[model samples]
Target: MLQHIKMYGAIVLAMIFWAFSFIWTKIAIESFQPVTLVTLRLVIAVLLLYAYAKATKKFQYIKRADLKWFVLLAFFEPYMYYMGETYSLTMLNPTLVAVIVATIPLFAPLFAFLFLKEKISPVNILGIVVSLLGVMMVIYEPQVGVETGFWGIILVFVAVFSAVFYAITLRKISSHYKTVNIILYQSIIGLFFFVPTFFITDYATITDIKITYKSLEALLMLAIFASVLAFVLFAGVVRKIGIAKTNVFVNLIPVFTAVFSWLLLGQQLGFNQWIGIVVVVSGLFVSQLSRKRKISEKIEEITQVTEY
Candidate 1:
């Protein structure tokens, strides 16, 4: 029970940090170009995580055999994922991007099954559908109806697949590396991708850059809370719970983002949005049904064996 509490707490907290990242990124992009912003975010996260791991004497060296796996993990995530999502924001409205991003877990079960041989339960499928419905309720307003282009939809879908593949690749190195080190190395290696792309894409725009204290604070918050700590906690949860079950918790991101927007940004929520939040929570509860019952059955078997 204690272990379950910790695992759930970690994932939920990770979601909260990520929810806040939306706000932070909004503030940050005011001063920095998207590619430039992501590169700097990676730079700061690498430095902070590397320093912490070194100070704690918990840094683990990567084996040569595992090097390719780490590279692939970084490619899937901070590289492809961020590149896709960030650029998509330029073409599409944030609401469309988010609703699309919220589909990550819907595709996760197939990847988890293919890569990790994890079984997907009917309840898990049902839960994902229900949660997706709730997400639409929260994010999709019939009145506003934001326009989207083909390229924008394509780019965000790139992000969705990148995230799915990232989770699959994470299982490759997560067991061998400490959570912090996994986040650290990924951030370090991610810079290789982000730096060149930054130069190629956003370099010309640099002359217009005027740094603001507010944007700096937002960037720093993104680095520390969103990139470093959130990745550590999320990686730890993935290692503990496996990808299919772990990704189910991702459905909470949009719901939490809405609530955070309401509270922090003074964005008033309507009745439908509040109802959507409740429905999203209910779906999360449904997804865990399989895990709980499977554990109970195992305990019964153990008891029976002891009686014999």
Candidate 2:
């Protein structure tokens, strides 16, 4: 019981860090270009992860055959995911971005069903439909007479799909590698993708760069808490409680983000947006019902099979 509590605590803590990451990314982008911020963030994460791996002697080399999988993971995640997310934040509010990202787990199971032949229940399908409606509500502002930041919403969805693909790729290599090693390699390979993009896109603006305390603080927090610590705690929780149960904690991210953005950034939601957030969160909860039911059924089957 105590062990379970601790694991739950860790998961919540990770969620808090991840929730705040949207705000941090928004702050960092004020001073750095999106690609530059992502590259520097990855560099910090890589150095921190490398030091931890070395100090603990937890390093493992990827088999030459499996190197491609890690490379692909890096491409989808720290590279593409960060690109989509950070760039979108430049155009969207932190709360809106966080709400969009909160839907990641809602879509992950669908991708799993598609790629891994996992069974998805009817409830999952309904949840997707409902959540998408909620997204539309959030993005559409009848008062403004336009969809709020349509391009930004589209880019945030790009991040969402990038993350879903990242999760899919992660399952392939997770069994073969430790979590730290996976993060370390991803961060390193992600740098390869980011460096060229940074130079091509933002190199000219580098000379005018003036770093402020707020931006630097945000960058370091993103590196330490969001990149390194959150992943470690989440991976650990997934190991202890299984992904379905572990993922329930993810629902709290947008809630936390909403509160943090309000408190820190003074961002406020309109009445319709609040309704949208509630609906989106409801859809997320609804989506998990099928997964929980499936897990229960699987356990029952295993029990009966064992008895026989």
Candidate 3:
């Protein structure tokens, strides 16, 4: 029971860090270009993860055959995912971006069904529709003359799909490597991708950059808490429990993001947005019903077999 509590605690902590990540990115990008910010963030994360791996002697070398998989993982995540997310935040509010990102788990099972031949239940389909409705509510403000942040919404969805793709690739390689090693490789390979883009896009204007305390603090929080600590905790939770169960905790991200954005950035959610958050979270819970039922049935089967 204690172990279960600790595991859940870690998962919640990860969610909190991830929720705050949107706000941090918003703050950091005030001074740094999107690609530049991501490059620096990855560099800091790589250094921290490397030190941790070396100190604990937890580093595991990847097989030559599996090098491509790690490269693909980095491409989907730190490359495409961060690009979509950071650039989108430049146009949208942190709370709105967080709400969009919260849909990753809602779509993961569908991607799994399509790519991995995983079974999808009717409830999962229904959850997708409901969650999408919730997303529309949050993104569309009726009182506003126009659909606010239209392009930003699209960019964030790109990030969402990128994350779903990343999750799929992660499952394929997770068994072969430790979590720290996987993230370490991702950060290193991701740097190679980010550095070139940063130089091409922002390097010429680098001299105009004025560093600020908030930006520095935000970058550090993102590298340490959001990137390293959150991934470590999440990977530990997934290993301790399972992906399906661990993913259910992702629903808490928007809630945490909403609160933190309000407290830190003074970003307030309207009534419709609040209602949308609830509906989205409800959909996430509904989607997991089928998976939970399967787990329970498996447990019952084992119990009966033992009794026999």
* Overall local distance difference test of candidate 1: 0.70
Which TM-score value belongs to model 2?
0.88
Q: Point out where model 3 deviates above 4 Å.
A: 1-8, 117-119, 142-148, 239-245, 292-308
Q: Per-residue lDDT for 221 in model 1?
A: 93
For candidate 2, write residues 116-217 as lDDT tens digits.
Answer: 677878887887888888877777654332444877888898888887777666666677877789878988998999999988999999988899999999
Could you give candidate 3's per-residue lDDT for residues 30-117 as a string of tens digits?
9999998999898998999999899889998889989899899889877988888999999888877887777676676677677767
Query: Measured by TM-score, how close is model 1 to the native structure?
Result: 0.76
Supply every candidate's count of residue pairs whose N, Cα or C atoms clash at under 3 angstroms.
Answer: 0, 0, 0
Question: Which scores better on TM-score, 1 or 3?
Answer: 3
Task: Give one digit per residue, the lDDT tens place, for model 1 in 1-308.
Answer: 99899889998898788777776776788899999999998888888888889988999998999989889988977799888887776665454455567656555565566655767678778867886687666655544435656576678889878877776666556567776777678778888888888889899889999999998998999889987777768767777777556656665676677667666656566678677666766765675564543322222221111100
Q: Is candidate 1 or candidate 2 better by TM-score?
A: 2
Q: Report, for every candidate in turn, its global Cα lDDT versus the true structure.
A: 0.70, 0.78, 0.78
Candidate 2 Cα errors over 4 Å, as ranges: 1-6, 113-119, 142-148, 290-308
Model 1, residue 94: distance off in Å is 6.5
Q: Number of clashing pairs, model 2?
A: 0
Candidate 2, clashing residue pairs?
Answer: none
Question: lDDT of candidate 3 vs native?
Answer: 0.78
